[model samples]
Target: MNVYFHTFGCKANQYDTEVVRQAFADRGAVVVDDPARADLAVVNSCTVTHTSEAKLRTFVRRLARGGQGLETVVMGCAAALDDGTIVALPSVRAVVGGADPGAVLRAAGLPAEASLPFPLSATRSGGQGVRSRGWLKIQDGCDEHCTFCATTIARGANRSRPVAEIVAEARLLAAHHAELVLTGVHIGTYGRDRTSHDTRRTTLGELLEALVRAVPAVRFRLSSIEATEVDDPIARLLIEAPRHLAAHLHAPLQSGSDRVLHRMGRHWYTAATYRKRIEWLAERLPILGLGADLITGFPAETEADHRATVELVRALPFTYLHVFPFSVRPDAPAARLRDQLPPAPIRDRAAELRELGEAKATAYRAARRGARADGVVSGRQGGKVEVLTEDYLSVYLPTAGWDLRPRFEVTVD
Candidate 1:
């Protein structure tokens, strides 16, 4: 039997998909490249936002009704919601909550044999590795209770993998994936479940230091971290370790107004505190790819609140912004709060924020003109190699034939 898979949501989900894919392959099922050609189609769903949920529902409907007679299975956070909702859908044949590979296999009528530890060979493709990038999940779930987040409800409490296990995987992946992103639902909360071998709490920085030493040749990047999690030592590591840790930070400043932040139940720090930390990092690592998440039209967010957000973003040297229009999920605390925003104004504000983000990105690219940098070549297009720079800039380099390699030392001109 042939199986086709489509993934949604975070890098953690991407890593989980790889795990699920391996289970099918081990059961003598061919994992096909196209959903249309497969006997079964599995959608690794996302329920992080209303838009994401709507997209998945639409895609599943289309996939089932396309006359391919596709047996559809849904997984991830979307499938975890009240089961009856997604499971009741006529298009969906089966549903698995969270990241359980066995459920997926059983749904496909494949043998539910014990999946061997992900083979070091899994990272290898065509005698190389992942070829582009590898996502390794080191932790899972969230402990934070952000009022607007539905993910925490679906994913549950935090749990971390042992350091030894992660290191072993990294050792093999280091040779294949030019860039390895260390991912989790809440990466910064890693090691919160485990006390030290000596009883001290292990920090995220400590994990990185170990990973750096274990795989000196690997280029590692964190997926997304809270602003409060980046303490002094973590900042030092980012500045000092060029070959190991990438010089890019994606910290979500969900809102720039303190009142909204309070309403959102993110009390670890204020907007000024977040800005100070960003500024401190920027001072040390100039040209750092500083990006953040912004939620426009949050509950009771006034014109002044919006302006505060705009001002904070403008003052900072941000390379990009993930502008999201607030959408209410009925289960979330924010959904029940007062003064819900209309769809039109939320869209307008989101658009404005995106335009501002584009301007920042353009300026960032322009500033890097004629600068020399090292990047991992993702693909070859025509006479140019597409390289993702250490600082996360996507640029094209002129090259051809045998000289084109996966990783490159080139100049941005």
Candidate 2:
């Protein structure tokens, strides 16, 4: 059987898709790129926002109506949140939750056993397949009770993979010559769900240390982390880690005003503290790439609050920003709050912030000129080949003798 997987939202979902792919392959199923060419289509859905949920619905409906003889499987957050809706869809044969990917594979008639552990000493040629980068989901779910988030209801409470199991997965990915990206729903909350007192529950910092030590040659990248999680120790690691480790950090700063943050039920660092952390990174790491997530037009968000957010982002050293016009979900607290701004103002604010983000990104790219950056040549466009840097910057390089797949260090000109 040929299987097509369509992954949506978050690095964690991408990682889960890969795991599902591996599971299918292990059960003698071939992975195909096009949905029309495959016997089954797995839609790994997302429900982070109302917009995301709508996308999931649209994709499922389109695939169902296409009549390619492909069986549709709806899994991940969207299915977890609205299993009834997904199951009632025209061609969806299964609805699997994000919690257990093995269940999805099982539903697809694949092997559902626990994965075997591979050792760290394995070589790149010994793994299952080849890829440039890999996302290892070391943690999943969240415990944060933020008012605007729907992830908690979809994914449940925080839980972490055992350190040994994560290390094994990293080793396998490294053996495949892939850069390992550590991902999760809430990575900072790792180890909070462990039951044994002496199990040596570790922080994200400690887990990172283990990965680096175990797979020294493989590049390691982190998914989005909270502002409060960026302590001095993690900051030091970000600055001093081997060059293989990408110098990119994505922290979510949902809002800038303390009042809005409090109303959202976020107890992490304040705006001042977030600024200090960014400053710490700027001083230590050269060519550091900073990304942030901002939600505008939340319930009760005044013009003053929006201005504070804009001002704070401008003052910070962020290379890019992901601006989301806040959407009210069914079960979240902010959904019922009063004084929601009109859609026009919400869109206007988002547009302004997006423009600011592009300017900041251009400045960041310009700053990288004359410096050497390590990246992989992804593909060719026109006559020039595109290079994707470790920190996720794309630069076009003149194609010559360089292999498009191999990682290389190119001097930015």
Q: Which candidate number maximizes lDDT?
A: 1
For model 1, how does the per-residue alpha-carbon lDDT over 1-413 read when each residue is reduced to its tens digit? 87888888878887878878777776787888777788888889888788888888888887787627778888888887744777766568889888778888887777675554555234644322226668788888888899889888888889887777888888888777767898999898888888755266677888888888888878888888887798766787789987678888889998889999999999887999988988888889965888898999999998788888899999988899999999998768999999998888888888988999999999998999889787887666677767888788887867644364667676775
| Global lDDT of model 1 | 0.81
For candidate 2, the per-residue lDDT at 289 reads: 78
What is the number of backbone collisions in each predicted candidate, taken in the order shown?
Answer: 0, 1
lDDT of candidate 2 over 293-331, digit per residue (tens): 988888888889889999999998889999999888876
Instruction: Give the clashing pairs for model 1.
Output: none
Kindly report which residue stretches of model 2 are placed more than 4 angstroms away from their true locations once superposed. 110-130, 195-198, 377-386, 398-400
Q: Each prediction's Cα RMSD?
A: 2.3, 3.0
Judging by TM-score against the true structure, name the best candidate.
1
lDDT scores of the candidates, listed in order? 0.81, 0.78
Error of 2 at 157 (Å): 1.2
